[model samples]
Target: MAGKSGKAFDFSLFRRLITYTNPYRLTFYFVAFSAILLAALSIVNPYLLKQVIDKTITPKNGDLLVYYITLMLVFLVVDVISQFLFIYFANWLGQEVIRDIRVKLFKHMLGFKKQYYDKSAVGRLVTRAVSDIETIASIFSQGLFMIISDLLKMLAILGYMAYQSWELTLLVFAVLPLIVYATRVFQKKMKAAFEEVRTQVSNLNSFVQERITGMKIVQLFTREETEYANFKKINEKHKKGWIKTVWYNSIFFPIAEMASSIVIGLIVWYGGLKAAQVDGMTLGLVIEFIQLSQILFRPLRQIADKFNTLQMGMVAANRVFAVLDTQSVIEDNGEEELIHVKGDISFDNVRFSYIPGEEVLKGISLEVKSGDTVAIVGATGAGKSTIINLLSRFYEIDSGVIAIDHTDIKTIKLKSLRDHIAVVLQDVFLFADTILNNITLNNPNISQDKVEQAAREIGIHDFITSLPGGYNYNVKERGVMLSSGQRQLISFLRAYVSNPEILVLDEATSSIDSHSEQLIQDATDKITKDRTSIVIAHRLATIKNADKIIVMDQGTIVEQGSHNELLEITDGYYRNLYEVQFASATTTE
Candidate 1:
């Protein structure tokens, strides 16, 4: 959702954006120099026209006339060169500024707490990073620098006209109040229209992104016609938002054109009358004033249009700055470096809540010994996944102490802590890249030999070689090119290559076929040998060989022991859960 704030023109936002150009100050100065030169060169053509009419052509002086014409040609060449410099340098500054800001914004997002993304829309964040940054680029490339050049040119033309004939100059400016009033009103209406258009664009992006991601559900439910109708309604609203801007432009430009033409007409008429009645007022001066009149009023009309680019850029800058100002980052205050951990984990009086007053884990305590394989089984929403989330420090508990080897986890550097652990989530995410690169994640330390060796050790090397491209095969966006089971196997190879001291498998085999499950179980056996392992599973059959099993219900541990030991408890929670959640898996196995 995009919203509008502040006045029509926000000077504070403009000031903030200008500071981004500090790194490119030299290029900005060159652009400023070019604008000044172009503005100074613009007045020469009209002044030379007066000289030709009064001093050369009127006196029948052929030699002087040729000289003035040649001088005009020289000025024309310089003007073209100055315009080129201004355009090139202005665009360069704009592009460089946006590049830096985009990188900074992305880096900031990477450090944000998981909670921030949990509440934010992917499409809205995408729009801010891409479309909004492009809009800000227009401020320098087409808005601010161009406005300055036009304004300076207008001032030069006005000064020359006043010097030539004060009477006609005053008359031309009589229409100023009317043009200014119309421009102010146009700006107010267009600002609102542009804000609405941006909001609709973000909405359209979010809707399309979500629908495409969940397209299987839509098709399975046979909601194609209904979805199409909904899209049309959103598209219609987007169309209407743009149409409102066009309507305002359609009305404003015509009025500005008419006003400019009327001013030129009045200048010609009044200047002619003065030449006949007043002393030192000649026909040539009247003609020169008409040319000057056109130059002055043209920029006035162009300025109104350029103002729209400026206003839109300001609005976009406001949105980007808001994201940068967010204080939801998980502070990395840990000074302790975790070089080699012993893999012992402890939870003491841990109390946590995703939302206030809705606690997910309540004062639970547990200890995991070194090299032990612990399986946690629980009903849906019974705080099973929450344990993994806390162990990885993806979230901070409301009140508790979680430690590794007797040191509080809060004292360990985030990078050092996470670097030693690997998580293979049920919903595996793979980038659109080669399979080998996905496994190694392009880490230089993990060579091709190491990756291939790890894949073989995990028993997926033959499966990879069976594919058309072997490890070079491209897994399209989100690994859509691969089957669900194949994707799961790739995730296993990825975690294996990392060679983490601690391994976490969260329902890794829940959605796989029996063959894939067997492969995963074999890989799990090899990888978890003499290493810490935590498995959260709904299917009890997979965790039967785990060293210990912890049964959870309502955010509390209800049963804890080995598989046979837990079954020995008469009518226990683990027994009931196994009968209800794992019976199908057991029969299939």
Candidate 2:
């Protein structure tokens, strides 16, 4: 069920997975050596039994018998030690390989552009980074090495049996084709059954994860009973898929056992008849053949199942490599580095779209000089937020130039470009961590004292101290424990502490309460005093005092002027929007 695709064995993918083990070549060699040693030890017991019964017991030499027994014990101890070394180090190699692969996968993902995440599923990535990578470990521990060990043991057993008695060897393996055929059939059926099983499990798990993450919506819409019924149907399908695999296993193993039992019976009967006919034949030879038969055939029954583990690793490797090979990363080829930003920002005929052929920003151009607080006011979907996104290089511009400090932003390195700008988004997202860490994002350069100072500048310091643990308080996931207004305040504090050269506020104060609005307003004034700032405000009253106001509609700027200048223009876009959005507040003030 864990294997992806269930496709024919891909040698290329297998080699790619093996590349992860190159860093531990010596350990791989040791494991291979152990497999060979274990195979050599497998036939020692049968050979010793033959020697004791024929050479010592038959002659009634007690000293020779004791010596042979002691030798047998010595080989038995060596066999146990070899087995322990083989298992422990094989598992160790599997673990180390997976650790390196998982880390590489995650680091590669970190470089992907935001557009990739907009179209990707969080749960799917989690599975690739977690469970899929885990399956690769079994390739070494249970799949490849163990299969080699078993096949080698079979070959060694056959070699010894042929040397001892060709007649006994031929008699015992007469049923080999039947057992092999049964195993092949079992493997085919199990593959299809497990594929269905995994499909059902994925459907079941995605349903549960989605429902739980949106449990608020479920209860609000009274869908608990409906979701439960849906879950039961998925669970039943999952169970049936598993039962089919179980049925195949139950049928196959017994057939193999029957074949094994028949071979042993044939061996005993033929060896006894030969013993009566030839003076060289002895009871000890028949006993040794019986022991050797079990040793040689037991792993044959399991070899097919072990091969499935290799198939799983190959399939997982294919999936992981697909992600690693994705071309969704933003090009970071810019050699120009920003040593100091002077906060001169501009967009010249900039255009962009989240989806091709549907432009979100259409030939929009604007400018904000250093130390100017410029406000962008527009209706929803008016491209106000799109401008800020392009400025931060979260998404590259489609056909225009965005610049800071009179230099093209595309010419600046991404880290250097982003380090000078801090954006406070409307819908704040905070980690499940302490307020201190959330504000600074655990950057070693930003100390707790710096965060406290930023909070004070924003007038949120007293409110933070009032929380149970002060700045040390944990916000839980997405800051769910805090109110919408509190989360916004924390986000503002986060941006303020960075001391970026350019500050972008995308409706950051839209969700704040009346009390918090005053706090944020004061903080906004203080934070935007000496910095180049662009504020996207839905509430028209918040930006009345800005040095310049830009009014946009449907991805194009309709008007630009000072607050009073735009207000006085009769039926101007800014004047009309301002009157409608804040008419009641204007009267009260």
Candidate 3:
């Protein structure tokens, strides 16, 4: 049953492919016409040969023989040109269709939420985006056009043979059922073999990519030989999969050939007897029947193989559809834009969970005025980041409502709400582009001066200007080209470039050196002076100037007050953190 489902390729994906090719419908129509012309012209050749042998050659009519021969040569030229035209158009259409599908798939993947990446393997996604799409292209280029051409030629040949000698045609096709039955069985086994091949290849690809990405760690730990053995084991598994695939393909062609040969032999022997018994059976007629029999059965063998190729394509289509069919749990609800946002934020009895029955935040209530600075301080896993995530609507809250500017976030457009906010995380992510481009990613209209101002505010402009390429210096992936402090400074500039009303600093300075951290601290002060800021920090010293600090432990807030007020709470978590920092400062002095 599962095998049947695999064969039941989604026609919608094919339909999508057709839609892409629709713009070039003229090319396809010409291709189809060219194929039909070629098929019609092929039928003429046999009749011409029959005439030359039965009439011209036997009767010694040199003029008629010459005329037939000239006609045959003309058809040969026309037919070759038509075949070339069909192939050229088919290839052209196939390439364009694949290009469109690839672009669409890439764009779709981009729109997916962060949660999508959390559950999907990069290797698997990359394979679907590349190799699977190529399979679709191959099917259209070879499989689709071949099916059309072969079926037409097969039908025309069979029809002609029946017209000439039905009795011999039926006798020759008697073993067709057995061939088809064998093909059906082989197809099932081949499907399994190919599916296993795909799986093993995906695993091998995933393992190799992961190992290469982490090669430094592997070599540092001195596990090269161990990793080599593991890789060899995976490669061996892939080899076994291909071996089974080869076996199925190997068996299918021989059985098809044997069946074809047996049928043709029977036709030859029977036809010879028929010619001897009937005076109407000419030698020319008998040879034509023999020649036509080969033509008919040859395509039968090829048709079965093409069917297998089509089946393999169907199997690949299932995987491609599986990716396109993924329903994003987090959707924009067609609300990605709104006119104005006041930036007043509130979480009223909000609740959430990463997984069912394991709530991370429970009935948390918090409100911040339009321009107030609210700092959340806690140990690790205290739901500090969760609060900001909810406000940003990255994940849907389990219960209760989160509102921005007194409007429920669900009703307001997601893009508009998020457009008013900025988040600078501890681990900064930079693209392999220039520094200016990274800073102004969300707002490309910003001038070079504006970008430099933002960077200088964070105190990284001087250092960046000293680089060989200056502002155009290409940062390596994940900003590996720069130190941790430099990356954080650029991240700060990125957030400030947006000029957001609501700014979020989630451990933004935790990885930076003390000097750079102070520079970032000064920039944060200036940027958040008139904005609503939510700082989720591990370092309590940084939030001392914050308007209000809400101290949390586990998933709930344990204290909420000014810095002095929280510090006076003798045995509180906040008080303990402050005392440790004070003692450390005195000891260093």
Candidate 4:
């Protein structure tokens, strides 16, 4: 529904699509010239046949016949070469256009804010970049200039037909109205059918992509049969959309073929009757008319189908352009650079919400002094993570100032601000690559030695080497091969490798085995020492040594103190949470 456009055969969108050809203007001109050459050459073969038939075959003049045949062969060779150029260059142009557009679209998508991703489906975006853009290539390869060439050739054949025998040409013209009416009807039907087909194709692509990505969940929940049924239903709709186009084709093509046959047969019969009475209506002329009619009708048939291809391409273009037209990206207008940061961060009365009319972070204020470690503990939906999200500029705050080192974050360049802060989130994402690549994220400047040093600092080098291939081990997609604790260690390595001035750990040590938890605590201690660290954890015991502890409830900070100071308040929120967690741990032991 996002890219829904009823704008079939729109000239403005067509012109916009053509602008991509500017970079390859020379190739575009050559492709167009080939189409024109092919169109002009299409008339030569029919005339050569006429010359051979009337002058040579009937009179048995064999000597000149060889010359005409040789001339025809030369034209045939030129035609073949011209055709090859048209096809090769046309397709090359289309591929180049799609490639450029795909790259631009991908770069545009990369700049969008997190909210854009929250609402859009990953599969739908893939369709926009991949299959939908692929359809646009047909616009150039077979759609625009192709229809022009066919029309030009049809006109040339008709003019030649009239020159040879006006009466037969008139007879051929008589069949044109019927074919025109059928084609007009067919075009309208096919246009609607194609739009539906493209929509269904996108739907099918989205369904398949999401299913494959979540195959593990499907199997774990034993919903294979249910998802299969769902897939079949979508597949059936996709088939029906294509079938509708076929149904229209089945009707239109036969009418075109029958009309072509009727025209040829009528010319032969009428031209024979008038051959003696009418001047220039020779047997040879009738043969020429028959040949001309086939050439003309063949492209007319193609014209109808190519129009549908062009329509389908426009439909795909509309979808792709919708994403490019989106203005959902964060504006980076700051000129201030963070050449050096003291790691002092403060939020003064900041308020923000993911959705309108529902506040997630109300006018709350906090501060982290340079080199100080702070811990935020809260229940779910208490706005614990939203604070860090704002601090990192993942989302803009609604009503207050967030600053780093006494400079307003809004005035500081986004990359510069983020460069000084390292955030290790709860969910670790690793690409299917070697662990070294995952830790450094393929940053060439961070050498193997640097990664080993960072891993050693986080106390994960021995653990990484204990694996099959040491630091070079392939972790596979999303690090599924490694345990949860191992993935966390990799994240720690990733954060430490950057050597940021500030580090934020969001619940890094939750839900781990005791042995791994001890290793993680050691790694956490090593990474947080002498750095500005903000830790968000549900386990209160883990943050007992935190320099300052803050407790949040319902988007407001209700308590703030050290662990001992908070425990002094018997009925305080932090004291109650600590008592509950500590009691739960004691019972489990």
Q: All models: lDDT?
A: 0.88, 0.86, 0.79, 0.89
lDDT string for model 2 (1-589, tens) is: 1244454455667777888889999999999999999899999989899889988998888999999999999999999999999999999999999999999999999988898998886666776788778887989999889999999998999898888899998986688889888877776676567556645655666677778878999999999999899889989998998899779878988888888899899988888898878575788889898999998789888886786676556556666787888888888888898987789988899988999999988998888999999999988999998898888787888898988988998888989988989998899999999999999998999998888887887799999999999999999998998998899889889999999989999998887789888888888898899999999998888899899999999989889999999989998988887777677776879
TM-scores for candidates 1 onward, in order: 0.97, 0.94, 0.90, 0.96
The TM-score between candidate 4 and the true structure equals 0.96
Pairs of residues clashing in candidate 3? none
Candidate 3, residues 1-589, lDDT tens digits: the string is 2324664344655565567778788987887887677667656777778788888887889999899999989988988888888888888887887788788778788767666787787887887888877777766667777677877887787788789878877876687788768867886777677777777877888888889878989999999999999999999999999999788778888988888788768877887777678565655666776677666667667766666566566556657667776775466764535456556888888888888898888778888888888899888888998898888878888899988778788886677778888999988899988888888874658988988887777566888899879888889787888888888888888888888988999998777889888878888897888888999887778889998898877777789988989888879889998888878978989
Scanning candidate 3 in windows of ten residues, the lowest lDDT window is 1-10
Full-model lDDT, candidate 3: 0.79
Task: Judging by lDDT against the true structure, name the best candidate.
Answer: 4
Flag clash pairs in model 4: none
Q: At residue 267, what lDDT does model 1 achieve?
A: 72
Candidate 1 lDDT, 236-273, residue by residue in tens: 99999999999999998999999888888897788777
Please identify which of the two predictions, 1 or 4, would achieve the higher lDDT against the true structure: 4
Query: If both were scored by TM-score, which would come out higher, candidate 2 or candidate 3?
Result: 2
Candidates by TM-score, descending order: 1, 4, 2, 3
The candidate, 3 or 4, that scores higher on TM-score is 4
Tell me the tens digit of each residue's lDDT in model 4 across 1-589: 3224444467778889999999999999998888778888988988888889889998999998999999999999999999888888999999999999999999999988888998998888988999999999999999987998898889888887788778888899999999989998887778788878887888898899889978999999999999999999999999999999999999999999999999989988898787767464667777778888999999999899999888888888888998999999877888999987788989899999999879998888999998889999899999998998888888888899998898999898888888889998888888999999998888888999989988787778899999999988999988989998888888888998899889999988886777887888998898889899999998888899999998999999999989999999979998888888888989999
**Candidate 4, position 292, lDDT:** 87
Error of 2 at 527 (Å): 1.4
